[model samples]
Target chain A: MAIRQLSVFLENKKGSLSEITNLLAEAKVDLRSMCIAETSNYGIVRIIANDPAKALEILIASGFAAQIRPVTAFAVPDQPGGLAQVLEILEENGINIEYMYALVTTIADKAYAVMRTDDEEKTEAVLAKNNIELLDEKNV
Target chain B: MENRKYYQPEFETMPVEDIKKLQSEKLIKQVKHVYENVPFYRARMDEKGVKPEDIKGIEDLYKLPFVEKSDLRDNYPYGMLAKPLADCVRIQSTSGTTGKRVIAYYTQYDIDLWEDCCARALVAAGADKEDVVQVSYGYGLFTGGPGLNGGSHKVGCLTLPMSSGNTERQLQFMTDLKATVLCCTPSYAAYLGESLKEMGYTPETIPLKAGIFGAEPWTSENRRQLEATLGIKAYDIYGLTEISGPGVSFECAEQGGMHINEDHFVAEIINPETGEPLPEGEKGELVFTCLDKEAFPMLRYRTRDICVLSRKPCSCGRTFIRMSKPMGRSDDMMIIRGVNVFPSQIEAVLLKEGYTPNYQIKLSRVNNNDTFDVFVELPPEQFDDSVKSISAKEASLRDAMRNMLGIGPAIHLVPPKTITRSEGKAVRIIDERKLHD
Candidate 1:
């Protein structure tokens, strides 16, 4: 199943992420899962918020370069090799993942993980064919 | 090779008095020619209360009015042409940097003399018919390629009009044809050298023996790097599209300073602020008076390049006066990778793109190459949360800048108010290269 993710472009400067968080806090938006990708010149903060659309709108209105995209989320056994198993299935199916991060919420005995791949349709199809449990936006 | 030492030995080896006499004669004749033909010069002369009869020789050159770069912009297309358009056969222009492009008209005779100057430069650089000359400078409207191309022909060398870029083909022809003389900007020469080294070729193994590099400022350190990397003697050639490109002045075997082609153009150093002529060997703004150019003859054109002139005899046996490599510019113009860039031009691009004019230019030299980056503040209204969308905007801005500047720079969209301003003025440029030093 697919859930929305917001990616914010920020300069690699002091207080940039803090300022963004402050703005989102003022807007009453909750960031569920987030990961930062850093480069020499700038950084990208990929986040899944309680209300992604609202968070994105507020970030843009506050003068931040941000965007929203659909990323697949799935639940795995709450064990050491849970992510490795999902990665193994995706690799065997030839689905290249651009990035992935773990989610805060999970089902009983299962951990939730978010993934973005080169071919989203194929990735979702392979995971579905493998019978791996997929989570929807409402589940996240 | 013809075993000839100089292209025009008579002019190049003339006595100091004879050179001055020749310049005076040409200046006197040129003054009357421009006064009679170009109304702009006449008006300036009239406004300054000076007449053609007053300019007897080079000593009285100060009596005439000095033409500034603004004057060129004020009279854009054909305003400064001393000859009619029909008589002009070619027009080479400076890469547009802010306002109107400065166009230089060239008649057939003007082209011939320009090529002759190039030939002199090539011969000075040890290029002859026996050497294969590869012209790597850009062609078409830019004078570096065409000027040196003609000069290579004049020198009777097997000329390769390779232009710029396409490293693979450049190397193929360079090695296959056994190119002995390479010509391009200092940075490009450095790149070719690095590429050659990566390809397992050393200076001893490379076929190149000499290189003519110019169209931008470079240091002796860069010269040493280019010379060692390419395994060739790197020589500096000086010129601008405003006053016939590439061969206005060039270095000889001595490599002390570039020798001005006094037989064609008269050189003078003047105080940048006061316009008073400075004596020889003192650094000041350099100026030129084209004595032979007919189509777009510029008289006492302020070059804005700060350098000194030397009359001390050179070991190279050329009696022509030598000009030190331009120390710095009097204006905010920066020669990045051999293209003129101005902060105002970058600011104009930002304003046109609906962004605030709050931007900063970061210039650095990495591995003997120039690295340029521009950082612009992202306005609140134009902020997009998507890195893809924002990166697309940056790419488009880079394309627009390349179209305007003839060189592309990495564009970064920084957060709003991040480009701090001091004293109500944003510090626009951060140059880490220390280019003037």
Candidate 2:
């Protein structure tokens, strides 16, 4: 299944990530997984949160450029090569992942990985065919 | 192209006394024209307790309050117009890299005189009707392309309005049309030169006889490289969008300094600190007063180009006063930790340290403190993306920059070609502090 994620544009200055996280915490929004892609001047912080709309509102109100994007989230075994198994499915299916991040659920004891791809529908179908367990907003 | 030294010989070779006489008459008239028409200029003049009568000749240029870049921004679109909107035929503007683009209006007459200046520049570069001129300066709100395009036609050259980019097509035209004169920024000219060699064409294979480069500050060593690479006489043309672009002054065969068009625009050098006019041959901020323009005539506008001026006689027989190549701009100086820094100084350090000149400076304000960082591109052979390797390179560059800039800068070692290439003006600085605006 697909989960909503927040992508915030932040300048490459100290405490920028902290500012975003602190803003989210102030809004009582719990983050699922986070990853950052950066260049020389600025960075894009991609984060899956429990309430994507609330998190995005907090960031935008704080003068940050933030947007919500649907990302595929799936759970794998909490062991080595857990990512390789899911990645092999996409690779064999000719699905390209733009970026991805992973985190292990404390209660479920299963590692969860969030992925953004060019073809979201294809990525979802391929992951399902590989017998991967997907997570929706409720599961997250 | 057959050699044609001067376009309008009378304007080009006018005696110093005659040039001054023409300038004085135009200055007195322009001052009155701006005061009566432009409310912005009138208010500024009124605020300074000065009148049009106070300005008689170029000597009184110092009495007028200086017009800074902010004035144009404050007055946005048509606030600075000195002519009726109906009479204005064209407009050119700045790139608005830092802030809003400053739009400059031009009447038909204004465009004519501007083109005349460019034609004169073309003649100085040995362009004639027999030549094929390929103008590569980016055309649009930018003044480089249109200014030279008109000039090329006025000179009766077979004009190729190629504008900028599309290197493959540019080379195709250059070879097919046998363009004898090239007009573009020095950076793009260098890229063309590099591409030509990569395509297996040597200087001997190229038919270019001359090139006119401007818009961005370039080094003397760069001029030499362009000359050697393209097998052409590289000339420097100076102008700003505020005061009729790309033909305000031009280098002739002498190549010592650019000869300012004293008839169309009056030139003055003033101490950046005190705004007092300096004697000829003293380095200071270059200022200008539009004498011939009918629309958007700026009076005593501070150009911020750091350079010197002289009236030395030239082998080209033009008696117009010449301006030394601009060293850097006073406005371009960055204040970091109470220390003044210029990006050119950093560029000099990078060049000396055997690195490509591709670099970017990012200034940000975090936690109420200014953070200055220089992102330099590493050549392919030396590029190491690892933390330890990049940190080491950054350390070395920081030390060198600290020695040159007095205050140390946080250096970021980026991979080669990460910094964007500029076609019009190379954007070397990005102040993130302005992001809020």
- Residues B1-437 of candidate 2 have per-residue lDDT tens digits of 44667898898899999998889899899989988998998999999999999988777778888888778878888888988999999998763323355789999999999999999999999999999999998788778899999999999999999988798999999998899999987767888898889899899899999999887666777788899999999999999888988899999989999999989998999999999899998999999989979888888888888899999888889999999888867787664432346676788789888787888988875532458988887654453222344567779999988766655889876544446668855579887652210
- What candidate 1 gets wrong by more than 4 Å, as runs, is A1-9, A22-40, A43-140, B420-424, B434-437
> For candidate 1, what's the TM-score of chain A, rounded to 2 decimals?
0.91
For residue A95, what is the lDDT in candidate 1?
Answer: 85
> Could you tell me every candidate's TM-score relative to the true structure?
0.83, 0.67
- Full-model lDDT, candidate 1: 0.89
The pairs that clash in candidate 1 are A65-B384, A65-B385, A66-B384, A66-B385, A66-B386, A67-B385, A67-B386
Q: Please provide, for model 2 over A75-101, each residue's C-alpha lDDT reduced to its tens digit, 9 standing for 90 to 100.
A: 875578878888888888888877777
In model 1, the Cα lDDT at residue B334 comes to 88
